[model samples]
Target: MVSIIGHHLINKEEGYQILLYLDPQLIEVADEFDESFQNKEDLRQVVNSYVKNRLPDLKVTVIRVVLGSLVIASIPLLPGTEIKDLDSSQELNLKTEVKEVFENTPQEIEKDLLLVNKNNSLADNYTPLNLIVPEVPFIFKGFHEKKLMAAKAATALEELFAAAKANNIELYAVSGYRSYQRQEVIFKSQVEKHGLLQANQISARPGESEHQTGLAMDVTSPQVKFKLVQEFGVTKEGQWLKEHAAGFGFIIRYPEGKDAVTGYQYEPWHIRYVGQEIAQKIASQDLTLEEYLA
Candidate 1:
């Protein structure tokens, strides 16, 4: 067990706990191989050797157990499977397999880390449950449907606003949830003015908008006249939000330099709620929502 730790086979305390909860027979095998292993790679080789010799039928499962759940789940496709080998029918079958695996994995599915972009659109009838207005300052006065966000996101936004206020930086919520119909109108208007190519870069097309998810909010400050603009990114409020929004479960949905990946122009004012843990990780890694989810 100590040798395993020394070899970095399990770096986290949670991994050790998981090992203990796993089959005791496997633990004995790990103990026997511990002294012989020099590092994680060596241990992996030994495990592969064992699987080849004694546990041929359980190779994938055993490899996954040893490597940790994240590695097992995060792979876009199955191990040893090539994208080129997949025909249309085989591709569908692979997608079904991956979807089934993700569905069965609660930790993966319950994170609310949904990805919404041009390629992945929500249904026109889709509406988030538990929509509520966040108790935060807004650019516009009075209640409006656009002020509403998913309950958890609303709560997080309130906390985020309070924190910003405490720093003497007043943050205002500009927009939140938008219905599919509202998105269609917004997109069409942008297209009429800016042309389709420019509109597609700046505005989401109907169901493709993150505003429909009720988990995204456009935040602004008085520095920018409470407007969402690229110049806002240079403001103190924007800098502060970029530095600390993750603390309250938010992330800059489309960061600068990630437009190609996110399928939209950089939106410094747009923040998406994906909870604290994930938000922190995404921010720390400097990843766009598309990259984080991918």
Candidate 2:
């Protein structure tokens, strides 16, 4: 028996497609993954390695399959490459134009690049524009406000999660787009549990939270039991975020040893999307958002 898994690199309606056919023994392993995957080069390498190790003598032919009603594009095949098309309706028209794939423009610089911190508090009634839920796995189920983020940031986040999946990394969203009132409740609770001083170090006041901007997200992995703890920074998923997040328009909001600059303890799980350009600059320079803006 073989298990087949499929994913679209772009929006569901278009882009390159990935289909994984795993033997029965590997089915259980593949079952653990979410429905979609990305990063064509990395996944292709992984599949090739697996096929080689499993059956060295087997001959493999790489051919693209066009499905019925599916407008497929960006197969990565060379020009004039012929593919097997199976259309349910009429004859399938083949187009071999090699256009760029996954070309998402970076989010607008002004709003998405907002700097939020203890000193830079938002207005009490401030709410971000275009809040939407990203199509990534979350630690909790059911409709909730924390699942929301600005539309542009959410799209970047989806790409980030897809890349993580392609690299065999599992990351889950824990929190996003919290309101000022919610922040107040959390801050008060933290203060009650661990004194006002400790709360100031760990929790943000109502108006002084990055979550209010809808550009920040807290992510975790199964290895850390989906908890927001400093230990998560050492896990493989967290390590991957540190190395690659900036490439996708995100950054570790509070890095270790920058507590003074950030006004908060190191929170490796918290990633803030500041668009790719600024994110990369801040990450490369090892500067906090405050420092970068300054």
Candidate 3:
């Protein structure tokens, strides 16, 4: 009985590990191997095939047992996967390996960490996976494409918004996801109104925009008249977000003085979800995503 476990090191120092234990039945015929002997292609194919067969009903529970408590990561998993108890000794060993992976090696970039900038552009036909509208107050009144965010980001945005509300700070979603065509129209308008140079500073050109990634959201407060402006950074809501956004897996993508690195003017309203651990690291170090990646 071999258990094929796929473990992603979320935060090794904190012992945060996300383990996906594929049901033995799912890969019963595959050779028994642990994390040390990962066959990435084979494992991906097996899981993907199982997911493809299920189609629309592929909701799965990923378990994270920390210390003696069971914590759920609330992300999808392959069906038939069960949570196995990891004794204290097994957990300690797992944490050590995860820590080594976290500190010693560079892993593939995740979707949440996808970078879209002037230099690194997304394809015209590129669309994010798992885009969904978050349940939060929006500046606009009707359903629009801008209301959508990637599923994971949407969940984090909701949590951030709720935290703001709990503290009596009102935040409104200004813009969420944007398609390449929409971004093109926006860029053209900006260029026509502000000329090419200024437009390039204030807006992104088509595929170069982070809004197309579905992981960024432009947020504002009533103080800023629900507009995306630098003044929003000084508002109470904005200040609150800067200090606490990372706690909910978001970062103020563009800060006051990093325009040279980010290739844009400071946009304090634009927040990108990069997961809690990375977001905290970026915020703590005061490094732009480009700087962090570099």
Cα deviation of 1 in candidate 2 (Å)?
66
Highest-lDDT candidate: 3
Candidate 3 TM-score, true structure as reference: 0.64
lDDT of each model, Cα atoms only? 0.65, 0.67, 0.68
**Which candidate, 1 or 2, would have the higher TM-score against the true structure?**
1
- Tell me the lDDT of candidate 2: 0.67
Instruction: Please write out the lDDT profile of model 2 over residues 126-190, one tens digit for every residue.
Output: 67778999999999899999999999999999999999999999999999999988998999999
Candidate 3, which segments miss by more than 4 Å at Cα? 1-110
Better of 1 and 3 by lDDT: 3
Ranking by lDDT: 3, 2, 1
Candidate ranking under TM-score, highest first, comes to 1, 3, 2
Give the Cα error of residue 276 in candidate 3, in Å. Answer: 0.4
Q: How big is the positional error of residue 20 in model 3, measured in Å on the Cα after superposition? A: 30
The local lDDT score (0 to 100) that residue 140 gets in candidate 1 is 86
Of 1 and 3, which scores higher on TM-score? Answer: 1
